[model samples]
Target chain A: MTDTITISVDAMGGDNAPRAVIHGASLALRERKNTRFIFHGRQEQIAPLLDEFPELRPASTVRHCETVIAMDEKPSQALRKGKGTSSMWMAIQAVKDGEADVAISGGNTGALMAMATFCLRPMKGISRPGIAAIWPTLRSDIIVLDMGATIGADAKQLVDYAILGSALARCLFDDDAPTVGLLNVGTEEVKGLDYIKEAGRVLTEASGSGFTYHGFVEGDDIGKGTVDVVVTEGFVGNIALKTAEGTARQVGSYLRSALKSNLMSRIGALFATSALNALRRKMDPRTVNGGVFMGLNGIVIKSHGGTDEIGYKSALSLSYEMARSRLIDKIGDTMQRFPIKVASEAPEAEPEANSA
Target chain B: MTDTITISVDAMGGDNAPRAVIHGASLALRERKNTRFIFHGRQEQIAPLLDEFPELRPASTVRHCETVIAMDEKPSQALRKGKGTSSMWMAIQAVKDGEADVAISGGNTGALMAMATFCLRPMKGISRPGIAAIWPTLRSDIIVLDMGATIGADAKQLVDYAILGSALARCLFDDDAPTVGLLNVGTEEVKGLDYIKEAGRVLTEASGSGFTYHGFVEGDDIGKGTVDVVVTEGFVGNIALKTAEGTARQVGSYLRSALKSNLMSRIGALFATSALNALRRKMDPRTVNGGVFMGLNGIVIKSHGGTDEIGYKSALSLSYEMARSRLIDKIGDTMQRFPIKVASEAPEAEPEANSA
Candidate 1:
């Protein structure tokens, strides 16, 4: 018998709102019979959606919230105004109160991260929480962290991310000792900023401490699956992620036009429809929708605000898997077993800048 | 009558050296009638390759150099050992001595940049030179600069890149007022590091200073053609460029497998061969081979060392276009017209780190 996993959902978050959230929970509940949901949003909006899913209604409970955080609201402003009442806040609050195992939101990333950090607080020995995104690669899925959870990171923080990311990799991939690589401008040992080199040195010293450290990897290595976890400051990591997404979209557009250029090609498209659909399924962003917030006291998975029901269901599934794997305990255990010792000459940590 | 544009070639630089260099020059000369070449490498190797093109033999002169910089050599090591006698050094030296209108090298990038900076020197008021790459977008080609010529950039240096990149944009795209954008994790003004925000403030203040400032653009905007020129530090810029390249390759691989999965798909691929070929041509990396060294006194174009003759020709063509357009003078004029004024409170410049 499996343990029942309860997920707190920000029902009024995301573009599709109550309908997509309720339907997504229904889909997720259908697959995992032991799963339950506590939806936090306005009762008027969510009641009708709940009625439409009779099966989900029995396994779910609604906690009405007065306000919702706007998608474009600044992190600080959202934190100030929506501290206790907003659906986004209440969803995360459920996790803090031990009412739910995980909190999932499709609200603005900055707001979601800010709320998660404030409500759950950072884990012991962790200064800031990093968002670890699962990237699809040619070989296998790789974990990339500091995906815009914070603007910058220092050598110690980078090591923290390494431990956090490797823990997540172990949880998701069932790998006992994941290979980690420091993201740099080049693979050469002497390239990139001082902080990166310092991080590389520390990671080198800490090799076989829960994870094996590959010296350095360039941005291209993310897609090549050069390592199980690619660690970097949030700024570069975020840019690389978005850039890859943009490039994939650009190539898809080119492919679409190529297949529709002429009558013969259109006929070819007809014959290759099934194959192309299979390819589409392989490349679909919905399958990989969750960005797990690492270093937080409790688990919080952020789903893309613009994603549909299918994407939301994927996020819920990720939350379920993470909850069952004891991710937080693993992270704490890794940090305790292999505490990072910063070199005396390592550069001082820079002040954090506000990020959205 | 057109003025004879002389280009210095590092014949022993690339993987298929002397042969590809001489052949690429021959191909470039056929298109641009008023072109001449000064090849710098081993006379024993270049002489035989030159014999194959009778017309090119008369239009080219060979300068012998004994030492060749290895691709894996560090920038500082290459600079110390191959300063005067190396083929790469002599090629840039030709441009400095007015023996050539432009210098072209398919050598190791770090060695080429180091040699170019040492021989030709940086333009006045410029701290370090940047490498501006022509990125293909859906609407048109856009210029992105500081493609790993240096590691980190200050606010002033970023503004300098804006001016430099726009000048390159004007020269290549024939745009009088090219729009420029600072690459950030998010388009929001409050997002990213302090230096990026400071750069944004300065650019906003200097809006009509030769180029129109489009504020901040995320990584996705590069392919969307949201701005005519994207300015960033080399660290992020290099990563974004390589990540995009990797994603395109990944997608292409998926497409290939999809079109060859079964007999029906294989037959479909046969019918769509012409259309697919057209798409392949559009996506070819060779078409955009050059990375122009900006903020330098003389023009230097770096080609991919691993590229073949056709790719080398594209770099040569880019050099010719830049030389003819008076790119250096344009950069100087832009600086003179609208000098960047960084705020007093802006962060101090970080020390340069060695990159390869």
Candidate 2:
């Protein structure tokens, strides 16, 4: 018999709390029979949902908590008020205390990141943590990182992200030598900032030693699957991710409007229902809803706060796969074995007196 | 009666060269009867094509040129080799010498920007030039800028883009106080780099003084029409633009595959041909093919190099509108009227000793 992978879930987190979390866990259990859950919230709220899934009853347990992090709470506020007794914190603490292999929360991103960092801490030799998403592309899925975990990154931080992302890709894709690319404005050698250029040089020198570094990639290259990992500072990465999502939604809306423009088109749409259903499945955002927080000592998957049960189940599945792969240990090993040279910061662009 | 808006066209610039360029100009003339064209390329190549349209013969003039800038030539290389005699250079020089009201080219982007900067120079009190695009949205079209003109910008340069973009918006959208936003990873006050925050503060201070500053906007806001203009550094801006394009194209491909998946869907598609045609029009990249180079003293619209007659005509139409609006002078007047404080450069993130 295989070992049961235990997941700590923050049941009081998300828009549709307790119910969606319990439902998602039950769904996950249905797909993976050797899975166990530790739901953290009010026992009274979660116990009734568990009763509905008798098959999941033997594999699940609940931990009572006094407080829950609010959806819009600032990171600073959440850290101060919701640190110890909150379900979000307790869920992360379960991973820290070795009670669970991974923690999954559909909470505010800022609060979750703050809690995860405070509880699990950054890995050895790493200064900051990054959030990564599995981006769906035309060719295949690629890993994109720093999806708003932090704003800016220095050259060393960028190289660190490359290592972290490469390691994650290795665990998820089972490809040891995943091709990595730094997202930049252009693919040319002399295109970006001093930090990006320096990181490119560092990756070039260390290429064959560990990961295969495929120089620079522009924005379009991400959807084209130009590399296995696309690394950038959080600000650009987050914008790119959201922009792609928004574009897909906008186009979907346009298609809907066009398909209903005339009487003949309305009949055509009815006949093409199955084909349209297949198209909707191909474009479903729920299939890729989880964002994995990397560069930490433990695994934490942050589900979208407003996602449905299907989305939450997808997140849980990703967390199980990551825990099974021992992603944190793999990242630690890769980073420790292969070191990169950080770019020397250039002297400040000299302060010009206010030219008004 | 419209004082004949003379346009200098680089007939040798694009992939289809004189053929597509001449056809596009004929199309433009049909829409705006008072428009006149000064074509720069081999007279033998353009004269025959112009002969196809009898009415265009009187309103068009062709200037013979010995050199043509190649599609793949680097900006720096093009600037060096094709300085004066090349068709692209001569087209811009027409605006510089008052021989034409505006210049339009379907040449390489970098080469076009380099030539425009060299020939037209930036307006007074502006350090760098930015490229602005009119993006179609669900609510209305919005203007997004710094679409890969230069790499990065300080707080001051970003504000300048705000001014330039707003001025263009005022001319095109006729909104006296266009809402402007600085693109960031998040809409919160405490996210993104120090420069973006500083720009936000500066713009906030100057809000009622000129354009309406709408604070920070995230990536999805661009398509949602959250602001009249979205200003960002070139790297992020370029990526957002290209990512949206790639996503739209990717979704289009998916829809095509879905419609052909079954015989019933095939029949459905045939019945919905007109509606599908309308949908195609809405998503056509050709309708938004031009990228306007702002902060320059002259109007220069860069059309996609691979565009056909339809796309080139769109670029020409934009040039006509900008020329009629006198966009260059409007931007200059706005900048000169409301000048804001430029940021004092901060010390660069210190170079850490190589930790490899």
Candidate 3:
């Protein structure tokens, strides 16, 4: 039974708190059947939430970690200072102790990222961890990475991101080695900055590698899904994520207004119920609540802090999928094949001079 | 009739130029009665296109300025080599000779900006001229500056961007002293880097000016039009523009697929024709084709390079409106009214940075 897929939940973390986390765990266990569950937080704090579920009370599989790192504190500082915090200690201990296959959180992003990087560590040959999220766009699915994970990046770093993304795509979708693209201001080779031009050269030169480098892709490409992986600096990635979310919400509202603008449209909406529901399901953030922390030795997920029980359940399901796929081992193998250190060793992390 | 609202046409500009530019001019002239058009380029090259539009040929409105600049050359180089080039010399000569109100382009952005800056010069009190684009978002209209004009900006520049944006919004929209917002990673007071944080303070405090500085706005806020004017670095502004465009295309396509999935849905779409048309109109980029290059001493509008007749029409409509609105005059007034200097004081006659 223990050999089956198992995930540890930071039961005391996130806005939904003890109940949503515990409920998610029970759902994962009941739904997956061969999964074991543990709630990481003080037993006293997590008990009431688990009690609400009732069925999992007799299950001895529930493990308790008695602390929680607050969502608002500095992640790195919280990791060191909040050592006794159940969420932090439990996540690290679970992976170290081999009690759980993966740890998931909807708590402090900085703290989770800090703990994950410091405790679990980056995979061998991996420069830094990247948080990869699948954006549902018009043409196809696009994987956007370094979304608030790696802060400032150079050309080589972005290339490495592309390689990691390709490997992840291969593992995630079993596609015939994905197409990689660097997000830039324009498609022309002369367009963008020195960093982008340099990255483009490296990517183009190494096109014989497993991933297909598709030169330059603009912001609009995220939704076009022309490439499997859209690589960009962390700052840009974060903006892209938020922008897409904002756009989805806006379009959703706009559609609502249009439909309600007239009586005939209202009647049409009633007839198009199934179609609208399908559209909503595809765009629904709750259906894909978890964002995976790739390039790390262990799998970590960042769920939306404002997620409800249904969203939490989706995150749990995503966690199970990651564990079953052995995403970490795959990323490790991929990074080992192509590392970030080969090119940047000469400059030794020198800062760029601002031309503007 | 020709003197009131004159605009110089870069007849040789854009990918499929001569024909497109000439056709657009004729269409604009035919549509807008008060405006006069000047076709500036080699007389030999301009005569044929003028001949094609006989209605425009007899008006003696097309002025001959013989020279043309390649789209890919450096801006400074374009200016230096622009003696015989129709696009450059004409655009420059028109503004300098008072032959046109604004020399609009579908040519090289850097060259247009460079020539405009060197010849007409920056408006007094304006140290750095940033391009402001009126972005249509989910919320209200957003005056986003430095869309690409001045990339790689620091905190001080961003503060100025916010200032310019707010002033533009107030004057243009009569927005009650429009709310100024610094675009950053988070809404929290201390969310982004020192640059962003510093900018945030300037916005909040109004930097000794009575600016209604709204708090920091997230990427999501742009569409909601939450703030009247949103300011950020040029790179960020570019990202926002593309991301918004890409997301809309993606979601719009997705809905189309969903709508066509079943027979009932197709029927539903037929009934919801008005609603769908309304959405289609909102999503069309053609409706908002003309992106103004604000902060320049003279108003220059960039029509899309790939634009068709409709796109040109949109550009003409926007240009005519902007001309009537006195955008340049308002910008100049704002620059003069502001407590800060528009351009750096006491020009050092320092060597230009991009001399090469």
Model 1 residue runs over 4 Å out of place are: A187-192, A343-356, B187-192, B343-356
Residue B190 alpha-carbon offset, candidate 2, angstroms: 3.7
lDDT of 2 by residue, B173-265 (tens): 988899999998773534437788889989998886558999999899988889999999988899899888888888998899999999999
lDDT of each residue in A84-121, candidate 3, tens digit only: 45565576557756778888888887667767776676
Q: What global local distance difference test value does model 2 have?
A: 0.85
Candidate 2 residue runs with Cα over 4 Å from true position: A187-192, A336-356, B187-192, B336-356
* Candidate 1 vs 3: which has more DockQ: 1
The best candidate in terms of lDDT: 1
Scored by TM-score, the top model is: 1
Candidate 2 per-residue lDDT, tens place, A1-356, comes to 13789999999989988888888888888999899999999998989998987787999989999898998887777887888899999999999999999999998888898889888888877767889999988888899998978677777777888899998998888898999999887735244477888888888887864479998888888888889999998888999999988888899999999899999998889888999999999899988879999988899999998988898899999999999998987888778767565542432211111110
Model 3 regions more than 4 Å off = A1-3, A51-60, A187-192, A343-356, B1-3, B15-32, B41-60, B65-84, B124-128, B187-192, B207-210, B340-356
Local accuracy of candidate 3 as per-residue lDDT tens digits, B97-167 = 77777677777776766666666666554555677777777666678777766556666677667666766
Q: Each model's TM-score? A: 0.96, 0.93, 0.89
Against the true structure, what is model 1's DockQ?
Answer: 0.68
Cα lDDT tens digits for candidate 1, B1-356: 13888889899988889788788888988999888899999999988888787789888899999999898887778888898999999999999998898999999888888788777777777777889999998878999988988777778788889989998988988889899999997836344378988888888888887899998899999988899999998988998999999899999989999998999999888888889999999999998999999988899999998988889889999999988998888999899987565533323322222333
Ranking by DockQ: 1, 2, 3
Residue-level lDDT of model 1, residues A4-96, one tens digit each, is 999999999899887888889999999998999999999999999888989998899999999999999877788888999999999999999
What lDDT does candidate 2 reach at residue B92?
96
lDDT of each: 0.87, 0.85, 0.71
Ranking by lDDT: 1, 2, 3
